[model samples]
Target: MIRWNVVLAGGIGSRFWPLSTPARPKQLLPLVTDAPMLRDTLDRLRPSAPPERTLVLTNAELRDAILALEPTLPPENVVAEPRPAGTCAALAWAASLIARRDGPEAVMVCTHADWAIGDVPQFRDTLDRAAETAATTHALVTVGIVPSRPDTGFGYIQPGTAIESAPGAAGEVRRVARFVEKPDQARATQMVADGFLWNSGIFAWRVGDLLEEIAALTPEVQPALVAAGTNLERFFADVQSIAIDVGVLERSARVLVLAGQFGWDDVGTWAALHRVRQHDGQDNAMSGPTYALAASGNVVHAEGTQVVLYGVNDLVVVAREGLVMVTTREHAANLKTLLDAMPAEVREP
Candidate 1:
């Protein structure tokens, strides 16, 4: 089966505050390594799906920037959503495009762009296995990450009874018992201890299988998809803002979860920098011109001048383009509320 990968790179990333804005969002920023997260994602998946087949779906405002970032990708392969139509609609459009070009049997690998993946080879290997499983069983396959800890920030997946491997795939595939929303700390801890895997948002499926499933299970976006044809803007205009997990995957009976274990994080908040970036003895991760002295568990990102932190612990400090933000690590995740309270002028720039 032909392999096609869809990299969804659309998000405002408000949690990153002054550093991440609409023009240069988290996926476009070089948060983890020297390159942007989208570039890292492309490099990792190109082995399985080349630039010819890989598609980068982003906001219409960010389309030009994405093209500038990945010049090797075909111009037509870079698609921009006219509006915020959610992943279900985005993937439906992508699958439709792939089906039109390659065929309905093509395997499409879908993932977000702004994520920190520590193991590159392992990540690609897991996707390969997931695609093989999809091709073999015609199942909507998802790579459920082996939970390293009880993370309340992410959704969890419960694996059911052991299932036979797909025809050519030799990976451990299990039926999806159930999909759980983000749980509280205690519930997350209990689920982790009970062998629930973190839903990594990495998926693989055949174009036909997914389209058939969407046509049967999800009427929220399917009717719009049918009416729009090649007009993606029309599709988005009519489709409801329902996530793929809820609109399709959660409702499908032909779903399989393959347990994956490669260091992965969605990097949703400023506090995630501590987990992904390299830290000093005091557990400080800094980017750009920044210095931390006797600062333990602090994340500093400075773009203009040097940022020196002394005698502070567990603080998130960021400086960029004359905007400076300082907040405690515990409070970093709630930057959305803080942004919402601020005026548009202050929040945008």
Candidate 2:
């Protein structure tokens, strides 16, 4: 078993706006299941690690909210970041904590909270292999999801030459050639044809090795890490915003990629419900009482309310207390822009 620390959870997720606010972010919303998304994320790893070993790094404002949702998790394990300094600082802070408490050789796995996994056994098997690979190779191991379709929203990982003598069970290790960000539709199709895997944002690494990579490659947060133990607020104020993918993963030479066959979905936008949830014969995904007439490929979420749609196709309708959002499925990806265009008084809670 490997020690796990989940990063990349502190997101407002404007893509799921109106329903997802700063106080209750996407991770806290019951998007995929009845329980909060974070709870599902934690449950996915329960077989490998216990609640005490799990660490959740969230914004200071949402600490109480996270704690309420997950009462079993230790209070101290729910680390509240002083500010939003991006994934680099978050990972560094988590690594610093783990290294100080545990040892340098202690392997840690990192993942996000707002994700849906269809197969738990496949996911655990992949993580077990990833942990063994990280411990044996002393390198950063990332789970590159086996692409089920041509997805342009996620990054792609190109596997390099295989590590023949790498320790671990069979089919556990492969060298990473490079990391590529989201490409255009045409390019994304070609990437799938070229055997590129979706960058699942799941990572495994040793505490000492990750610290070394952060110190060397990410200067924006290096000083923050050095000053982390003393004052978290001061450290956060001094660091620049940068994601771990740009700061370390892209620059690190010792990165390894393992093909993950488990079904995974980031559940990024309202349109993504078509992939995450079960659709009816009319191609509509309805959570509550929703009657669709001549409508196909629509996502309707009505919380204790009756919704009636007629002659609407490819639309997202979400009805909740003090909020009613109706937008085309194509426009779901641009919800942030829509929120920005609204008045402040209407936008502010």
Candidate 3:
């Protein structure tokens, strides 16, 4: 039994441009299905915990918009980060709050709000198991997806030794040998062959255990514990920016990874629609007033207008009121480069 808190919803998500604006990011868009990606994430967690226990950490600029989108959650539960201090600070802050409200024994399951899990039941089961592993082992646990393909986009986790079988379950808990960032094509293929699991960025830990790990591994946010109530803004401003994976999980000695079988995909780019969304017979993902002809393996999303595509293969086509973007699906992951190359006036709405 764990109380989960989700984060990283304020991003502009330029990879899903046109539909994804500064006012409404990808998490707020119905990228995969009818509901927004954030909404889907919240719905998935409902079986494990209620809205009161689940906190949403996001930027101040998008706070009101997020609240408007998810009016069901308590306004207070929607935490507005004073600044973008990265996951190390954000997770530390959320863990501190959970420890204060609930007891330090409270287990917190942390995840991003913009992912797509194919099987809801398996997702819940894996998360519940991870929570148990965290509570009993007192170790920081991360869910590693059983890779179905050699995905170079996601990080890889190497399992060390099996700790114990998950009480009557088929597979056992395992010690994490090492964490590897996104690798080259050959390395990714070899890793898949070597039984590597995709690092799903799903984490579980006791509030107290995580706080202690932050104190030991991440000195950047350590001071915030004392300044939390007094000067929150100054505390966030002063902390060094780092992700939890780099600051704590990678350095900490007490880390474990559990193999997750549920279909998981981090819909981080336009190209990811192929993995998460329903495709046609020719392998095209069409959404929001879109029609494809002679377009194989393409992703087309129209925000408020009709988009007609023809003779385009492996392309990402998007059309909205103010803008339209057309590019190869292979280049969809690197939209930042396109944004960087564009003029500010044209880029900004």
Candidate 4:
């Protein structure tokens, strides 16, 4: 079956402030490995879908940078959104393009460009299985990550009855019962105990299936999609900004969930480095020349300077471009608030 990779790589990623700026966002930074996160994502997807079939949806300002980073990708394939129209509009436009070029039966494997995924083979296997399920069942398939923790940061998916897999299918597929928003700690714990999967945002569907679903269930984007035809700017301008989950998947009946356990982490905040990156014996995830003395459970990223942390626990220390930011892991998640309180020059830099 023909498969296309659609990567959503927008946003300046304010959570990673002091390091992530408008000119160089989180996806372009080498947060996880030596390479940029977007580069890593593209490399991982290259084995399944070639660079020609890969489409990256990013901000208009980031288009040139993305193109420069991913030189192998066709210039046309790097879609630049005129405005922030959210994932529904982005995916709809991508599906329209795929349908016009590769026909309706082609499956689109969707993922974000700023995630950290372990077990590359298993991740590809899961995507293949989701693609197969989407093709055979004509269902919008979402890969729900098996919860490694009761993470209150992520949304949860409730799987309904099991669906019979097609011949030579990879794994189990189930109908989605409901979508739950981010819950409180107690609720998250209860949901995890009750068999809820973290909404990993990995999705697959035939171009036609997605288009049909958009037309049927998504009023927020459908009219603009139909009126714009091939004009991406017009579509973005007219379409209401809404996430794909809220606009289509949560409301659609043809949604299927495939449980995936390939060590997926969104790497959403500075604290996330502790989970994705390798740690020293003291459980400190460090990059560049960093030393942790009498410290444990800390995340430190240093660039062009040495960072030394002492007598700290669960703290985040980042040094870049002559700027140093030190905060507890708990406070790292709310860097946007700190950025808002700071001067524009300091915040942007």
Candidate 5:
């Protein structure tokens, strides 16, 4: 029933400060491989959803760049958000477009443009399962990654009672017992040990169902949707910025979670490269002609210059555009704070 896909690609990727700027965010960067993350995302989904049926929602400033990345998609398909209304409004608008074109019953698969999925086949399978589950159950569906580690940066979902799949066979389907945001290290570890799943931010739902739930449960974005029909600017101004998880998934009772284990990583910060990128024997993940003599647990991204890490461990080194930044892995995600403290001359181009 999934006839369309809505890809959210508007984030500025503040966590990756030095490399990710307003014009060129992490979504446009080749952090995972040689191609841009957005391009990789489209390519990953093309097998199940064609570019004709896909709609990309991005900021006004980055519309041209996104359209340039995929020429097969019509110019109108690359929609530029009039304002930063967050994911809830974006998804709502996307669902409205799908409903208008494909009818209310058409299922839409929603995902972000900036994610590192290791197993493409398994990843597609999980999404397909989510789409199938949503089609048959007529419920908002989310894919929950089987926790591989105690990641404090991501939200966790506790699964509830099991349910039968579309074929009446018992599947990994379960009602979401609870949703917990980024937690302390102790709590994250305990949750992982207790079989909690990482909130993958992947969703599937019919346009009618999603809109109905939003109208009933999320009042903040519901009014905006009414305005979205006529005036997008007023809609963004009226709605409070809210993520789909908090605005809809957490509050909606008709939500289901499916256990997913396909090597998923958010790649939120520079340090995340160590987890998603391929590493050498020394446990170093490097790109753009780099060598490590004895480095271990270091993530390096070099461009326009060769970088060699000697006997360094747990460090992040980035070289680009004549600017070099070096920081410990633990401090890599804090680059935003560092950028804030830097003078405007040094912070912005």
Candidate 6:
């Protein structure tokens, strides 16, 4: 089966505000490395799926910018979503396009545009395994990251009965018992102890399988998909805005979970930088001209300016274009609430 890489890159990341604007969202910004997170994601999948086969589904306004960032990708492959319909609509559209182009047997490895993957080789291996599993078993496969900590920010997946490995398969695959939403601290701790994996949002399935599941289980998306045909704009207009996890995967009986252990992080907030980016001797993740003196456990990103932290810890300081923001690591996670309280000019700029 032909393998396709489908990247869902359509969100304005409000969590990393001040630095991440609508025009230049977190996926386009250099959060992890010198290159943008989207670039890193595309590069990571390049070996398995070439540029021609890789599809990026992003907002209509960001389509031109996405093409500019990854010039190697075919212009037609950079799909422009007319509106902010959720992942269910996005993937349904992508799967329809792929099915029309390459037939339904083609496998699509779906992932978000922004993530921090530490071990590239292992990540590729796991994705390859997932694609193979999807192809062989014809089941919707999601790669669940082995939790390094009790992170209350991400959803948890409980693995059920182990599916006996196919001959020569390298990893274990299990039926999904249940999916738990972001729980409280105590619940997260207990779930982690019980070997529940983080719902990494990494999925693989044949275009046929995904479409079948959508038609069978997702009434919110199925009718729109059937009526829209190849009309992208109509599909978005007609579909209900529901996440794929809720609309399809969680409800599908054919869902399978595979454990991934390659140091995966969603990079959801500014504080996540400390875990993904390289840290200094003082244990601070510094970018641009940043210096942490007598301080530790801080994340500082400076643009066209110098930032120095003294006698402070667990702070997130971001400076760019004459605007400076300082907040505790704890508060940095809820930048949307902060943005709501800020003035229009300051928030937009």
TM-score of 1: 0.97
Candidate 4 per-residue lDDT, tens place, 1-349, comes to 9999999999999899888988899999999999999999999999999889999999999999999998999999999999998899999999999999999999999999999999999999999988998999999999999999999999999988888764234437888999999999999999999999999999999999999999999999999999999998888889999999999999899999999999899999999999999989999999999887899999999999999888989989999866999999999999888987999887765
Q: What is the alpha-carbon lDDT of model 5 when measured against the actual structure?
A: 0.88
Residue 54, candidate 1: alpha-carbon lDDT: 94
Q: What TM value does model 3 have?
A: 0.95
Question: What's model 4's overall lDDT?
Answer: 0.93
* Candidate 6 lDDT, 1-349, residue by residue in tens: 7999999999899999889888999999999999999999999999998999999999998999999999999999999988998999899999999999999999999999899999999999999989999999999999999999999999999999888864124448999999999999999999999999999999999999999999999999999999988888898889999999999988999999999999899999999999999999999999999877899999999999999899999999999987999999999999889998999998875
Q: Give me candidate 5's TM-score against the actual structure.
A: 0.96
lDDT of 5 at 36: 96
Least well predicted 10-residue stretch by lDDT in candidate 4: 163-172
**What does candidate 4 score on TM?**
0.98
Report residue 245 deviation for candidate 6 (angstroms): 0.7
Q: Alpha-carbon error at 145 in model 6, in Å?
A: 0.7
TM-score of each: 0.97, 0.96, 0.95, 0.98, 0.96, 0.98
TM-score of 6: 0.98
Q: List the residue pairs that clash in candidate 3.
A: none
- What overall lDDT goes with each candidate model? 0.90, 0.86, 0.85, 0.93, 0.88, 0.93
Q: For model 4, which pairs clash? A: none
Kindly report which residue stretches of model 5 are placed more than 4 angstroms away from their true locations once superposed: 165-169
Candidate 2 regions with alpha-carbon error over 4 angstroms: 167-172
What's the distance in Å from true for residue 190, model 5?
1.4
